[model samples]
Target chain A: MYNKIGPIFKKEFSSYFNSSIAYVFIVLFIFIPNLMFFYFFGGIFKEEMATMRRFFQMMPYVFIIFIPGLTMGSWAKEKNEGTIEMLFTFPISQWKVIAGKFFAAWALVGIAVGSTLFIPILTQLTMGDFDWGQIFTQYVGAMLMAATYIAITFFMSSLTMELIDSFLLSSSILLLLTLCGYITSAYVMIFPDWLGWLKVILNEISLSTHFNNFSKGVIHTKDVVYYLGLAMLFFYFNMKSLESRKWS
Target chain B: MISVKNLVKSYGHGKPAVKGVTFTIGKGEIVGLLGPNGAGKSTIMKIITGFLNPSEGEVLVDGLNTIDNPIEIKSKIGYLPEKSPMYQDMIVYEYLKFISEIRGISNEKADDAIQSMIKLVALEKVASKRISELSNGYKKRVGLASAMIHDPEILILDEPTAGLDPNQIIMFRKILRKLSEKKTIILSTHVLSEIEAMCEKVIIINNGEKVADNSIQELMKTYDKEQFIDFVVEGESLLSIEDEISQIKGAWKIEFEKKEGKNQFRFKALISEGSDFEKNLKSNSNNWKLVSSEIKKANLEEIFLKLTSQGEDNV
Candidate 1:
């Protein structure tokens, strides 16, 4: 399994660099947030900031576009080119291919996320008194959040034949999943009394509600499990989609 | 080495693509799957390669069921899909290496296998180029190389020469002929001449049914009972010659074509069973110049249409 997954991961990982999109995605991911933090939220990064809190705080939301953009073609493009047939016919299992692509997309997203480490590194030098632990936890939270989005969209890529459709569907679903958490987390109850149970369930299931723990420098086992569990479940869905052709 | 038993597949709507088709292929035999477009040739090949499962039947490769032992069967068979879609972003060498790795070739042997495949497919010149940059013919060669990189005992190619030019098709056939010496090959094509050129056995499918499966020579003789009195004649107007040829008993015209602005005409007539049409044609009219005349058996093309068209008499 490792032998098969290892080569697929390597090929898939490099496939990102094979096109200009990886560079484009990395540039945009690093710039938009940092650009906004310094330009729009300048006050937050000033003396009020002991950690790079504002920058990492909004990453999960920003990933709604970038993550889907990278993964919309993971399976969709293969289907368009008819390469998926050859890929699936190999002596490997479907799970390994999905896992390989998962890690590849996850690793590419990691690089996009990792490239922004210069932000915290340079900011820590200038501030001279920064909570490195908070920054680390924030990075971890952002990555975990990105992993969930990648898995979900990777599965979305397999559901559709067109790249545009995959991107639209993935972003819409990610937007909904991420937004439900934000809406449910407010202190005042936003829904009617009868619908209060829905808000509770949405909060429990919302991605940001779970991500809120890590962004706040708290690495709870529950939040970690939530992100990891959601990622695996979606990965399984992607495998199921690949195997659907065989389903009578 | 491969057996398909009562294969049936449906896309979950309308009619089943393949219906109860059964055939077995021997080891090292080059079999051509002959069918028109949308005739379920690719569907059956997919089931045998383990890319898709049969809805009602089972495919066995060397006694191992495709559903139960897919990986083992897939490893034994090398498949090239229709139109040869590839990862255009990858270089030819990188693509082959990746396929070799997926084929479970060890790191130590992978390089040698890649080199040999490049040489075999004549892809050395464009080995470093991206697949998208290559022409259709070269891209097909790359697809063939990637399929055969592992050197499996069985090779399944779906319309391998679908888009190639005449020169490339000839070259591709040469490579396939070489491979057939040691491997069992099942290649599907609508072009009947390709089967005549490369395969010893032909399996013809029509409308989700196996119409005929036989040796090329057997298919020609068994299904093609219509005998043709093929002849070429030269005459002016030929109005007199036509009326005379039409008067002959036990003979009906099958095809006729007159060369443009010329006195030459080529025609074939299907003679009735055991009739003396050849002698009657000689006695009927001697006005036209008889450039050539011969009574011949129907070729593979005529036999294929007769079998696949289901007695519609496409001729």
Candidate 2:
């Protein structure tokens, strides 16, 4: 199984490194978030700074767009060119193929996330005081968020052969997850106590609520479970989508 | 060896793409799967390769069921699909190397196999070129090299020469023939001439069912024992001449077509055993002039059309 998966990882990684698309995505993911933080929230560098709160605040929005763009073509291109049929004819299992592609895309996002560490390092150099625990916690939160988004986008890519369709479907799902908190809060404010069950379910499904806890340097087991559960859910669906093509 | 029993595959609950298709290819035989377009040749190939599961029935390769032991079966087979599916962004050497590693080949052997396959397929000239830059023929050669890189015992090729020039077609056929010496080959093509040139046995499918499966010689024998003779004659209203020829003692069936101008007609007559066709044409008293006459042998094309087309007389 490792032998079968190793080649897929190497091929995908080489594709990401050789193409300019990876560079473009890395630049946008790192520079845009920092640029936004510096331009809008200049108080992050103030003498009475408490934590890297502003940086983590900007990650959800940054990842909402960046993750979809990075993963929109993970499996769509293979299906479009009929290479998936050739790959399936090999001795490798379907689960290994899916796991290999998912891990490769996650690793690419990990590189992009790693590049942003320079910003925090710069702040620690220029400023005497910085919250190390908060910064570490926020990095963990960003990794989890990106992993979940990558899984969702990879699943959407497997569901369609058209790249544009994959992009649209991924972005729409990300947008919904990002806005779930606001939608749930509004429902609680307008509805009466009789229909309060709707608000309870909405809050449980909201990813932002769990991300907020992690962003604030709080390592709750429930939050970890939430992100891991979502990731597994999407990955399972991705495998199922691939298997369904054989019968259809 | 490969064996398929009552293989049935359907798409979206509609009519079956391959219905009750059953055939077997021995370890050293090179069999050709001949069929027209949409005749379920690819579907059968897909099932045998373990790329698609059959809706009903079983496929056994080398004594292992395709569904129960797909990975083991897949490792024993190499396949080249109809479209020549390839990663266009990969260089020729890189793509073959990736396939080698994926198939669990060690580094030293992978290197040696890649070298041999590149030489075998004559891809040494453009080994470093990306697949997109190569011509269609070169891309197809790369696909073939990838399929053979692992040294599998069986090869399934679908329309392997679909997009090649006449010279490339000849070269491709030569490559397949050479490869068949060491591997069982199941070559599928709609071109009847290629089947005639390469395959010892031919299996034809029509409307998703096996219509005929036999050697080329056996298929020819099923039509009729009467031999057909084509002659060029100078005459009008050859119908009367055909009627007259049909009335002869040994002439079974006679037909004629006018060859435009010069008052020439192309005539064909089926003659029974011990009948001298040349002698009978010469002994005729009519004003018909016999230019030339020869025994016509039925090629695969005629047999293919006769088996596939509806409402056509058997002879």
Candidate 3:
């Protein structure tokens, strides 16, 4: 299993690095958030906050588009180019292949997220105050959020052979999850008291609702479980999609 | 070494792509998978490769079940899909190097493997070129190189020579033959000549089912009774000749076609075994002159059409 996944990871990583697409996305992932922070929120470094509130806050939206782009071609491109058939003939577990691809994409997102740490480090050097705990919490939160999104995108990609369809499907789901809380709150305001339970269910499904607490410098166990569980759920679904394609 | 048992794969609960494919490819055997379009050839190949799970049966590679120990089974096999699956941006050497590394070869071994495979496939001229820049035939060579770079025991190739020039196809076949000395090869192609020339064993598939699985020699023997003799005749009108030829004893079937302006008729006479049909044609000289008459052996093309088309009707 390790041997199989190791090659898969290497192939996927090289595929990302050799293509200009990865560099383009890396630039957008890092530059756009900081640029927006500088133009709207005043330079992040000037604020002296170890917790990257601006960066972490913008990631949910950034990843809404970026994660789908990164994962849209994962299984979809393999299927499209007929490589998936090649991959299956090898003596490797289906889950290992899925994990190999998932972690490789996650690692790229990890590197992209890690690059923005320079901004926080610059703030710590110039400004006197730095909350190490809060920064760590926010970084963990960002990683978890990215992991969940990557899993979702990978699952969506596995279900379709078309890159555009994978992208649209993943983005649409992300959009719905991103807006779930707001949509539910608006419904609750107009609905009866008994129907307020719908808001609780909607909030539970909203990724941002759980991520927001972690971004605020508190590492809640429930939030950690939520993120990890969501990631695993999507990963499992991705494997099943691949397995189902063989018979279907 | 691979064993597939009663494998069935259906697309969306419709007609099964592979209804019940069962075969065993022993170690060092080069098997040719022959079929026409939509014959579930690719699907069966996929199932054996562990890419697509079998809906109703099991596949075992080297005694390891594909479903239970896919990784171990995969490590023993290398596969090239019909379209030459590859990363277009990476250089040929770099791509092979990556595959070598992923297959868990050491740096030194990876280097040696890559070097040998590049030489084996004659990719040295364009080793540094990006895969996207290579020609279709070259890309196929690269795909074959990747499949062999790891030195796996089994190689599964789908349509390995689909889009190559005649010269390239010959070279590719030579390379495959060389590799088969050390590895088992399952080659799928619609072309019958590929099987007759390269394969020791043949499996004919149609509509996702195995119609015939036997040695090439055995398949020929099965149809030996239906032997055909082709005769090119000069100075003969085909219309007048048909009745005289049909009346001959032991002539089970007769088909004739005329050549323009030449007064020549090509006759295909089907005869039973032990019949002196050639002597009978020679004796009838005044009615029709036998320009040339020889027994034509059944080639893979005829065998494939006979098996698949007739096999489908039986099913």
lDDT assessment of candidate 3? 0.82
Give the TM-score of chain A, superposed on the true chain A, for all candidates in the order listed. Answer: 0.95, 0.93, 0.93
i-RMSD values for every candidate model: 1.1, 0.9, 2.3
C-alpha DockQ for predicted model 2: 0.63
Cα TM-score of candidate 2: 0.88
Better of 1 and 3 by DockQ: 1
Task: Give, for candidate 1 chain B, the lowest lDDT window spanning 10 residues.
Answer: B306-315
Model 2: how far residue A119 lies from native, Å: 1.2
Each prediction's DockQ against the real complex = 0.65, 0.63, 0.49
Q: Rank candidates by lDDT, best first.
A: 1, 2, 3
lDDT of 1 by residue, A14-95 (tens): 9989999899999998889988878887735574676676777687789989999999999999988888888888999989
> Which scores higher on TM-score, 2 or 3?
2
Q: In angstroms, give how far residue B57 of model 1 lies from its true place.
A: 0.8
lDDT of 3 by residue, B67-103 (tens): 7887787788888988888878888988888778667
Q: What TM-score goes with each of the models?
A: 0.90, 0.88, 0.84
Candidate 2 chain B lowest-lDDT run of ten: B306-315
DockQ, candidate no. 1: 0.65
- Could you tell me the TM-score of candidate 1? 0.90
Full ranking by DockQ = 1, 2, 3
